[model samples]
Target chain A: MIWQLDIMFLVLVVISAIASVNVKDLLSSAILLGAYSFLMCLLWIEMGAVDVAFTEAAVGAGISTAFFIGFIFQTTRRTKD
Target chain B: MKERYPDVTIETVCRLLIPPIQLFGLYVIAHGHYSPGGGFQGGCILGASFIMMFIAYDIGEVKRRMREKLNTILCATGVLIYAGIGILCLVLGANYLDYGILHQILPAYPAKARALGTFGIEIGVGITVMSVMISIFLNIGTAGEHEGEPE
Candidate 1:
């Protein structure tokens, strides 16, 4: 595993995590969370955990994103806080 | 959902994309023993294809194709298959889920029987995961009331 790619993904993961939590628009937050999942999937692949990476990409990035979007359609887009 | 705004481009793209996506999912499930992918990942891919259909088309369209009763039955069937395999192993004079014992009935070597048994469980898991995912998405999309009204 290249240390540089690992570091890059690590940084991006942190940024996306924080951004997803802090974003006011729930839809954008959901999308950001999906991005976070994908980055984590990348990290898993780099670490040689191919199975986990596959799972993360499928369930974390794909299904959960769709679930969040479906939920958002039923709720308010903007946060109260 | 009641009011339809049909987009030809989206419909065309999804129709073209879904078949290949499903085929890949099946491939993942079938090759899972030797590959990085397995039942859960493959099933999620399959479910995602349906979710894409839901987005591009209408919920009614999806529901019509896969009725709620059929979905529930499929969900149960997968679990039954999984349990049945385990119990079969037990009845074959081995511990639960002991695949090596399957050779007595399968006419294969012990090691090959183990692989076959694992493959069977994976199929069961893939089926369960796919149905559950679709069920969750449908419930969420419809807010727990998926019947009576088209909305």
Candidate 2:
């Protein structure tokens, strides 16, 4: 059962990471990146490293995503592709 | 503050959600010892609460509510607290974080002293993480790009 959850979360992570890179709208991509980080946090929990999971959730999901969104606010929200 | 956007329902919902989210973040921080969550996770959640406000309201309101100078101070102070604890241990002629000395000073359970010491450092890390996260957001969100968009 735990392995199933891991697999499911892994799938979501892959999807979010790919979408974060591929999405045209900058805000959406940033949101997706946050999603990816959230999933990675869950993965860390599953791996039994609460400290690492906490750090990842804090830095990756909270800080990095906000930074990306701030870039969008200061610049264009659209992409060439 | 700028005019609240003409979405009464959204505003109402956000007003209700903010308190609960913030409270949950606090709970996560406090109950970190016997649980999977900790200062960093709780701090991230706390930062998210502000970010949500920023998105729901506006940047100007966020700036007013959480001034940049205060956040900078919090970030720096958090690190100082952590480093101070480590240095205190060093001064006491032990390793970087010999919590036993702390126990000796506190005049209580030694193991509890260790736990409390760790908790203090974790709190410091949390504060730094929270403020740094907000700083990164403010910096990135407000930066001006070069005038080279593909027009």
Candidate 3:
């Protein structure tokens, strides 16, 4: 069961990353990055690095995503690439 | 006052939804040790909660909710609290973060002393993380708005 969860989490991370890169809208891409961080946090929990996981969840999901959105606001949301 | 942006369904949903989630994030920080989380995790969660608010609501609304001064205070306080623990340990004649000495001073069990110490530092981390997040969000959202204008 644990292994299954791990695999699923990994797949989710990959999907989120791919979506983040492929998404045309910067805001949506930022959201995907946040999702990626959240999944990574779960993966850390499964790996038993609770402390690292906690930090990741907070900084990665919270700070980074917020920063990304803020960046989006100061500029245009649509990206050419 | 001027309207900076248009009202939308998504922003409306965010206005209704985000405050409660932020409260939960605080709970996560407070109860981190006992659960599967700690200060940094909870702090980030708290930060994210506000960030969500910033994103969903317009910048003006976010600014109204989070003032620049308070964010500065939060950042400094977190560091002070973290340093306070190390100072306490040093005052007790041990290296930084040497909780055993704290245990010697307190009448309670040594494990309890260590736990308490950890909690203190964790609180510091949480505060730092949350404030830094807010600051970052504000900076990013507001960047280049008045870049070359005289302050």
Best by TM-score: 1
Give the per-residue lDDT digits (tens) of candidate 3, residues A23-51: 98888999999999999999998989887
Ranked by DockQ from best down, the candidates are: 1, 3, 2
Error of 2 at B136 (Å): 1.6
What lDDT tens digits, residue by residue, belong to model 2 across residues A1-81? 399988999999999999889998878989999999999999999978878888788779876787676666666436567
Better of 1 and 2 by DockQ: 1
Per-prediction backbone clash count:
0, 2, 1
Residue pairs with backbone overlap in model 3: A58-B44
Each candidate's B-chain TM-score, in sequence, is: 0.94, 0.86, 0.81
lDDT of 2 by residue, B1-151 (tens): 2245757776678789989988988887777887867777888887888887776776666777777778889999889989998888788777898876787677778788888878878788778877877766655555532122122
lDDT of 3 by residue, B1-151 (tens): 1235656987778777787777777788778778877777777777777777766665555556766677789899999999988999999899998877788777868789988888888889989988887777666667735222122
Error of 2 at B4 (Å): 7.1
Better candidate number, 1 or 3, judged by lDDT: 1
Which one wins on lDDT?
A: 1
Question: True interface contacts reproduced by each model, as a fraction?
Answer: 0.90, 0.79, 0.93
Q: Top model by DockQ, which number? A: 1
Give per-residue CA lDDT, model 1, range A1-81, as digits (tens): 999999999999999999999998889999999999999999999999999999999999999999999998888646689
Give each prediction's DockQ, rounded to 2 decimals. Answer: 0.91, 0.53, 0.66
